[model samples]
Target chain A: MISQNSQTILNVQNLHANTQNTEILKGINLTVKSGEIHAIMGLNGSGKSTLAKVLAGHPDYEITQGSIQFDQQDLLALDSEERAQAGVFLAFQYPIEIPGVANSQFLRLAYNTIQSKRGNDELDPLEFDDFVREKMKLLEMNPDFLDRSVNEGFSGGEKKRNEILQMALLEPKLGVLDETDSGLDIDALKIVAKGVNHLSNEHNAMILITHYQRLLDHIVPDYVHVMESGRIIKTGGKELALELEKHGYDWLHDNLQNNAGATA
Target chain B: MNALANIDYLSSLLQTLSTQNPGDFPKDLLPENNFPWLKQLRTQAIDQAGQFKWPTTRDEEWRFTDISPLSTLTFKPAQPGNSPALADVSPFFIEEANNRLVFVDGFFTPELSNVNHKNQLVVGNLAELATSHSDVIEHHLGQHFKSQKNLFSALNTAFLKDCAVIIAPQNTVITQPVHILYIATQAETTHYPRCLVVGQTNSQATVIEDYIALQKPANSSYITNSVAEFSLAANAQIRHFRIQRENSSAFHLANCAVSLDYASRYQAVSVTLGASISRYNLDIGLRAEAAECIIDGLALISSDQLADTHTCIDHLQPNCVSHQQHKCIADEGAHAVFNGKIIVRPDAQRTDSSQSSRNLLLSNQAKIDAKPQLEIFADDVKCAHGATVGQLDNEEIFYLKSRGIPELTARNLLTYAFGAEILNRISIASLKHTLEQIVLNQTQHH
Candidate 1:
């Protein structure tokens, strides 16, 4: 048995998934420990987003060959909402706009869904309101934002902040931030990073999927993984991100091509 | 054969009033035989009514709404009654400066009607105005609203003796809306109330028609066949509203036909709250460029009642637009029907039209039939139509319930949201407030 301090919270081995017969994530392996922040950086079409979506059990992606375990439980065996109740949260890159549904109301639903799955009594409106207001204050969000429609007519900054707000409310064990830094200004980036930092604890983990090293300046991940052609070609510490920024991805591409030629 | 003979006997009795010499029938009245086309049209109407069987469940349009009660009636044509004084019907309108037309048993009560400006407002019988204003009457009386295939409209044109005529001249804006109140008094009787409104170029006006049943016991069974026609010239604007609050034993068949020229606008609103069986047909024609029309309707039905609204907007010219939205809330064993068609012709390019019909069924027994159709021949136009029938949203209800609001209050709030889309379009403040109140009361108690 692995020690509690070093036990893996999530383990994905050679994950191969496809959507409509088109392979998206090919031969990927990842491991995340509790209380750690990992950043996955790749170019467009490199399947970084696809990996995040597959981890969350999105219906559009079919897992062809993969084994995912969360807390030693089978992760791929669960459905989307069930995966959600099992303490997996994905901050959507482009959050769905559900007209006529309030933001706070949606959060309460997600929170209650998790609670009920854990065999707990659902909080009534007053209790939920009190609970949500406290979390909103911690994020510096106006309490009135909870009454507005879910992501309807919300600005980019507000949408990203609301995503963090949801993460705070649900308090999931594993969170995937999918392109959360896209379309945000510098000030918004700091606020979002601060919220995310505040939510991470000894039992919870987060994976930040992005393309720019600029977002890394704020989140400051413990490790950075470089992905190319649906495979993690390199993994290093925070200084490796600075090295990639200075040398660009061309050096890594050349190294990968030489390595593949030698192996063939 | 027996029913035809009975109606024939009633027709002869009604014809006796026509024989009271042309002098007694008012000097300005149009001679019935002079309008050859109307004569032919009337005969066609009577013949068509005789050809088709009464609407039954076998017909697709009338499937959900059973007309058995209407078919079983042997309704005699209502004659002018003498018991209720004209003052009884005249009190429905304000006593301020304006015009009022009151009809009892389908006959115009001239003494009760007060026309402040005879030239601006023409408040008299249709036959009388046809003779006085022949040039205007000859060109428009039946020109816009022909019976064609509509049997009820044809029957209304055939018995067009005692209808109301209202005409506003060019650039004239009537401060007060002209009110026409029709009261049904006798049991097992039928009344056809027709009204014609013409707004010349650059004119603005409002017309309100209220149909109420006034009887002691209020259990009288009757049928009202009503038709209204409007013609708006360029830059003319008109607001027309109809409120039907008849007794539960009454059957109502109403039609509103409108025509708009270049750059003109017209709005037609119908509110159906009462009556056992009610049907409203609205047809709007935009014949020139930049013309706009809006038809907003709502129906609140309960207690085994049936309400049906059929609307059609024909875009015949380029750059013309029209919008239609209808909502129905059914409770108890009630059923509602909505059929909206928007047609864009080949020449009507750049036309923008949209239609939506939504129904909320409050009970398991309640049902709704919603059909929103678009027939577009123009390729460059933006035309879309949709229809949805469902119950209250469970998530919305749960959300509301979590806010300390009782389950019933939450239900009412969500229901109000369902009906708010159409009510918010009403431009008049007082009317909208009154409608909101009525809707709240109806939803809360139910």
Candidate 2:
């Protein structure tokens, strides 16, 4: 899908970010085109989720030195909601539970807010309910989830599917999914992958930050990047993910160190 | 507000409270000839009200709640001024309610009241049913509240000339809910609104005790000392909805006590939303085996308002179950207090009880003091209690914001959700929708 005219949806250059007092992301570089799917694989503390949150303009993180050009505009200038309205979405690894607010109402508000920003005709409650239900079917989500509280009392797989369901509804230009496949079972993961794939067009992009190659099988990333300690050390094609799956991270680390020693 | 702070002695405050407000207490009490027992109860309560010291923050129960500002208001007793027409009061009316008893300035207004139930259900003013239901009233009136000896209850009982009373006899089930409206017409006056609900054997009913201001609430700085007593017979059930939305400048002190017999059930949802200082004490006693009760409450306050709710569910017999959940949402410099107490006696084995108090502070200056108390003596009983006071969850807000909702809308959604948890438990659909809309508006654009 990386054609000649595919737009550059995101470009991160020397991105250095900090949370509170600690520098989490130190001089990172990444670029995602409109039709490209990038999979950033790393361990637990590798700051993959931090990158996703920073892209979504989460209030906790501060960019000390970096520039994120999203769709040829500065992404860092927008607030969280403004970033969302600009078609940037982050599917949280641990989705926060909002009790007492119905999922349908929240979904409609979000959908309408984004649609209004895009100059599209926003759907009313009944229209949105029907629309969301169709999108939910893509994720194999039960219609009953629309009435319940957002993410409250939902099963792990169900919460993951809900995140994907939201992704299908928002139809963001750049979707930063942080560990969305971690808690999902095989069936849910495929359903979520199908939902995400259905939303991806040549005008949009996705950044999949996952720990397992199992998800990359269904999503099929164009680029596989290995990150260590807040920096992307190695980049390769889709086969690199399978290699990482077989040898684990130590193979890449050893090769990286040997190459560094030879080069020095 | 600081004027009452200078009076250090509660006794002197109590003295001034009683002497300056002659008309605040009933002058010509219900005649002893017709209602001698009630007259005696009122007389005893009058003496109790006289001797009792004004509650202060020094008392364990009143700690964190300072009601001394009540002395600043002129204790002029409100009168039954021009009664509000149907249009003025109809906004507070529940659409499904067929029976209603209206009280204007603590005096039962027969012209505005109506009871249309064809069954053996008794719903009307207490004074009107004095002759026929006298025996029933005599046995239950002030019977549950007599032991509490609370100064506010005593003051309310002393003014027990007239109040809303609903008596559901054996095997009777009320089809529609009964609405008891307590309206304040005149400002700067002290009024006492009382309620007595008796559910006989195997009977069932729903009663709504609502407080409202006749005109604009800001101008009505009345002092309302209200008391409501519910007594349930064997296998009976009563669903009560008590709403206290007095004026912002008013003081509302209310006492509600319930006694459940064998296999009976009592469920109440009390919402407190107004008043400069409001205190509601609710006590439920499960007197027999297999009795059950669910007590839920919510208080939404902002500005200089202070709302306090103290609830006690006593499991006195074995095989009883009680569940209580109280929530408060405080913004601005407002203060909200919730004290939920659950007691399981020695003989109350196999009793299951749980209590939780959730308070949401919407601002840094907003204060909430939530205390959950569990007293269990039976090892075989199951008891659980918890209390939490916090601001809106930032992660939750971010989650909503990530979904394209604005930050203010997200915060309002969380705040509305916190208060709506209790309001959703309200059995009445119209009232639930109303209160939910009110909370929605209160949490918006702030």
RMSD of each: 8.7, 3.8
Measured against the true structure, the TM-scores of the candidates, in listed sequence, are 0.63, 0.91
Cα lDDT tens digits, model 1, B379-404, are 99988777889988765554333222
User: Whole-model lDDT for model 2 versus the true structure?
Assistant: 0.86
Candidate 2 residues B248-268, lDDT tens each?
Answer: 877888999999999999999
- Model 1, span A83-155: residue lDDT tens: 7777888887876554445677667766776788778889988999999999887667888888776777888
Judging by TM-score against the true structure, name the best candidate.
2
Shift of residue B65 alpha carbon in model 1, Å = 3.5
Report how closely model 2 matches the true complex, as a DockQ value: 0.65
DockQ of each: 0.04, 0.65
TM-score (C-alpha) between model 1 and the true structure: 0.63
- Candidate 2 wrongly placed segments (more than 4 Å): A258-264, B1-30, B72-82, B215-218
Q: Pick the candidate with the highest DockQ.
A: 2
Regions of candidate 1 where Cα sits further than 4 Å from its true position: A1-264, B1-53, B60-63, B82-98, B110-114, B118-124
